[model samples]
Target: MSRTRFKVILYLDETEFSRAAAIYSAILMMNMPNMHLTIVRLKESNQSLLEIDEKCQNIWPTTSDVPQNALDVFLARSKDVQQQVLYSNPNIPDAVTALLAYVNKWAIDLIVMGAGEFSKIKEVIFGSLAYSLQNRSPIPVLLVKELSQDFLEGCNLTPTLTIVPKNQHGN
Candidate 1:
């Protein structure tokens, strides 16, 4: 059977590891041949870089931060990698709406975003974007809280886990 392309959208904003997540996602995407990574940055700023082309190999994806900053990172990558990347910055009024629109438009399989830190009062007043996305997103939403390398190095997930039946009779 042919493997379907797995599209993962890496949502970026003003949060910890937001920039680094792009590089990390790219590296992670490299390992998964069938996976396509699209980096999305929605924050508005004075500077912006808009480069979205399917045939162009040297084009960059859109970013809300300093245009060159995002470009410099991707520019340093090989042409093959650059060509595989597809970027888009939605112009919708609400962030959740914008992200959801892109998700449907791109036929995204998964949505990955950094787990931002927000004060309790702020969350109570404004609400958490991550939480809202998790609740509203049609597909699965993965929240990144730490560097992949750190988490991978610290935890060994290969061990065989024993399964205990939940309906077992009392001993």
Candidate 2:
């Protein structure tokens, strides 16, 4: 769809890595003012939604511990921002079902997450969270490696895939 009104869900969970996703989302938001961003903060069973909400409400107005924290606080205050706790469960491969449901309900264009590198063999055997989303998500799933300035120019990207199909002649 158009980047002007792109709907993005920054998948933030318990991982310290989620900060990267938040920063990436913020950059994209800044670049495209019309872009609608929803921060999905995934909390574990130890935290109640009430507790999380209370803490966020407190922090959004007062938190300036870090640049990322301040950015998140500002984002939380923005009218476009939608903070969803989703469940008592944590953000894992198991959470994909709930996330997919949300994606369908809101028509999310993309799911941006911070993914830690894993061995191919490990992923093939046990599977990883990122791969799980990649395989399952109907919409595009972005696993942020590093922030790029390309997003600053509205990300006019046309990705090229290496895979090619054989012709009827089987060249």
lDDT of 1 by residue, 79-159 (tens): 323332223334322557667776787798988777766788987787776778888999998876656667546533222
* Native RMSD of candidate 1 (Å): 11.6
lDDT value for model 1: 0.58
Off by over 4 Å in 2: 1-4, 44-77, 88-93, 147-171
In candidate 1, stretches whose alpha carbon ends up further than 4 angstroms from where it belongs are 43-93, 119-121, 152-171
RMSD of each: 11.6, 12.4
What is the clash count for each candidate, in the order shown?
A: 0, 0
RMSD of model 2, in Å? 12.4
What C-alpha lDDT, on a 0 to 100 scale, does residue 12 get in candidate 2? 69
Who wins the TM-score comparison? 2
Weakest 10 consecutive residues of candidate 1 by summed lDDT:
77-86
TM-score list, all predictions = 0.57, 0.63
Q: Please report, in order, the local distance difference test score of every candidate based on alpha carbons.
A: 0.58, 0.62
